[model samples]
Target: MADELTTRSALQLRDLVAHGEVSAEEVARAHLERVAATDDQLKAFVTVTDDAALAHARDIDRRRAAEEPVGALAGVPLALKDVLCTKGVRTTCGSRILQTYRPPYDAGVVERLRDADVVVLGKANCDEFAMGSSCENSAFFPTRNPWDLDRVPGGSSGGSVAAVAGFQAPLGVGTDTGGSIRQPAALCGLVGVKPTYGAVSRYGLIAFASSLDQAGPIARSVTDAAHLLAAIAGPDPRDSTSIPKPLPDVLAGLDDGVSGLRIGVVAEFMAEGMSDGVRAMVEASVERLAGLGAEIVEVSLPHAGYGLAAYYLIAPSEASSNLSRYDGVRYGLRVDGATTEAMMAATREAGFGSEVKRRIMIGTYALSAGYYDAYYAQAQRVRTLIARDFAAAFETCDVLVGPTSPTVAFPLGELTADPLAMYANDVYAVPASLAGLPAMSLPVGLGEAGMPVGFQIMAPLLRDDLMLRAARALEAEVGFDAMPRGPNALAGAAI
Candidate 1:
């Protein structure tokens, strides 16, 4: 019974716990046990709050015993990416500088999780400051894909996806700046969503690129992701960029199939850099959608090809500004020196990893005095053009479709020495992020190397529900298996 608990979806656990078939404590314990059993090899978690998680679960059971009303997600397990502050829990942002730093208050989303009664298993690891395309840039360790233990679980949000894919947790929260959530979800063979820029509040979320960093849900199924996303989506006065309006009821029309809806295929995305297996799977998924009463149309995003170049400039520029707060002063690590300037330099030199340092330099150079207009301003103009491209494409279609990543998961350290090669992996995902659109990566089926292939869906800004409906409609048809079958997966697990 305990082992079976680890295999159930978030909604399954919630129903079981709500109906008294299984106590919340049992559910939490089952996943914690799985974490203990597999995290050594997967390195998905930076810290495991076993005691706090079990205690919270027990409290939920207590409340239910007294006939008290519960939140929407009353009893389910979640793996929170370390970038979100958790009050007493350490929020490392997967960087060595802040490894021991704990926030004094919870992020807005964390507060929502507590209200919803979601049990957070732990703080999952990630690329230092969410800077890299692969999980290899973490200051402490790398996260391995559950589908193949030897490969990366695409990154920045790699650990969050790893935990959910490996059955250590049924749900996760990962921020997407440039495909951090979707890319990892694609590689790990799970579902990951990136809400529109202002759909979710960013208060207490450690900023990477303030304009692009939006946290979303990671789950094994689209329904579970919708549940998680709704619970955390709302306006917050603390976040100026947050949308004043509320997100619609995503679950209400989730089962509304793709009949009579137009799904646009980006001509640029399907034309290049696709591996044979991934191309085959994507084409097949599109055909399957067409057979489900959806109109298939070809759309062109002329400026889409420039998304990667613009993102590298804009994201790093914001990162360079946001990360300047860690100057050996207010919080986190501080190395003492005779002069204050020397102290700050020494601390940063030791605290930041190679990738983080690299981006900071690039951003600094781009935002420097003379080059601001030439580089930074030019990139913003290009970003506007990408948004226009998306607008033009959406004029004729309800949603746009493409392969999430060009290829499936690659072996760890394969492109570590080649930064450009690693950055190219985000070609399909960066465009949507640049446009501040709601996008998701849905697991179509297994592709090259028996790894997962992601069928990405993009909807107009604030219309995340359309993509969810489209994804759910096809998810039912394809029936992709998310359970990990790797050597490190839980015993009895199958792909």
Candidate 2:
């Protein structure tokens, strides 16, 4: 019965708790036990807050018993990516520097989650400072894809998505800066959302690429993703970039099928480089959408090819600026030296990992005198062009469709030796981030090695509801079997 509870969707669990069929404590314990059982193999979490979770669950049960008002996601268990600040709980962005650093206050989204009565199971792992495409860059440990133990769970939200996919959590919150959330959600066979920039507050989220980082939901189903998005989507005065308006009704028209919706297929995305199996699966997904009455059209984003190069420059430059606050004098790890400059250098050298160092170097170089205009400034220009492409394309289509990644989950260390190869994993997902548009990845089917392939749906800026509606429509048609298979399936079953 506990394992059965673990397999249920977030909404299903919520319903059970609401109807008195089961206590929230039972649901929380079920997932916590699953995490304990599998995290050694999955490495999906940096910390597990069993006590806090049970306390929150019991509180929710008390509120229900008293007939008091409860938030939308009351008692749902969730995994939070370590990038979000959690008061008194260590939030390590998968780096040694801030491994012991606990925020004095919660991030805006975290506060909202608490208000919604969501029980955070723990802090999920990620690439050090959310800089890498694969979780292997973690200063602590790499997260393995649940579909195949030897493969990487896509990152920097690898652990967050893995928790959901591996049945350790029903929902997860992860920040997407250049595909961190969606890519991992793809590899893990989950519904991952990258809401439009400012759709969710970025106030307490540790900076990556400020312009690109947006926190969103990773869930087992599209409907669950929408519910999670609703809980955290409103404006926050703490975040200057937050959209100063009420969030749209995402669940209002979620069930309205995409009968007459126009879904544009990016001609460039279909050209080459992706594995044949992934391409076939994505193409089949598009066909399935068409069969469900979506109007299919081929659209061109001539500047789309440059998105990768532009992102590498722009994201790194921003990272360099944001990370400079981590000098020896501040809150996180500090290495002492004879002089201030020496201490700063020593602290950074000791604190940051190899990938973080590589990006800081690239970013500093790009932002250096005489090179800013040629690199960082030009990347910003390319960003504008990419946004223009999305705007122009959206004029003819309601949303764009493509493969979330070039291939499914790859073995650990496969691309670790080649940074360029690792960066290419975001080729399909980055354009939406660069454009600050809303995008999502949902499993269409399995591809090579029996790993999941995601079909991405993107909408114009501030149109997250539209994007999710299309995803839900297709999700209903595809009926993706999100259950884990093989040995991993047995793990969940035995939990």
Give the range of the ten consecutive residues with the poorest summed lDDT in model 2: 485-494
The CA-based lDDT of model 1 is what? Answer: 0.92
For all candidates in order, the CA lDDT equals: 0.92, 0.93
Question: What is the per-residue lDDT of model 2 for residues 1-495, given as tens digits with 9 covering 90 to 100?
Answer: 666898899999999999989999999999999999899999999999999999999999999999998889998999999999999999889988898998999999999999999999999999999998889999999998888888998999999999999988899999999999999999888999999999999999999999999999999999999999999999999999999997688999999989999999999999998998899999999999999999999999999999999999999999999999989786899999999999999999999999999999999999999999999999999999999999999999999999999999998999999999999999999999999999999999999878899999999988899999999989998889887775543255337
* Clashing residue pair totals per candidate (backbone < 3 A): 0, 0
| Regions of candidate 2 where Cα sits further than 4 Å from its true position | 487-490
Q: Let me know the TM-score candidate 1 reaches against the reference structure.
A: 0.98
Per-model TM-score, in order, reads 0.98, 0.99
Q: For residues 213-329, could you state the per-residue lDDT of candidate 1 as single tens digits? A: 999999999999999999999999899999999987788899999999999999999998989889999999999999999999999999999999999999989999999999989
CA RMSD for every model? 1.3, 1.0
**Which clashing pairs does model 2 show?**
none
lDDT of 1 at 263: 93
lDDT of 1 at 147: 81
Off by over 4 Å in 1: 486-491
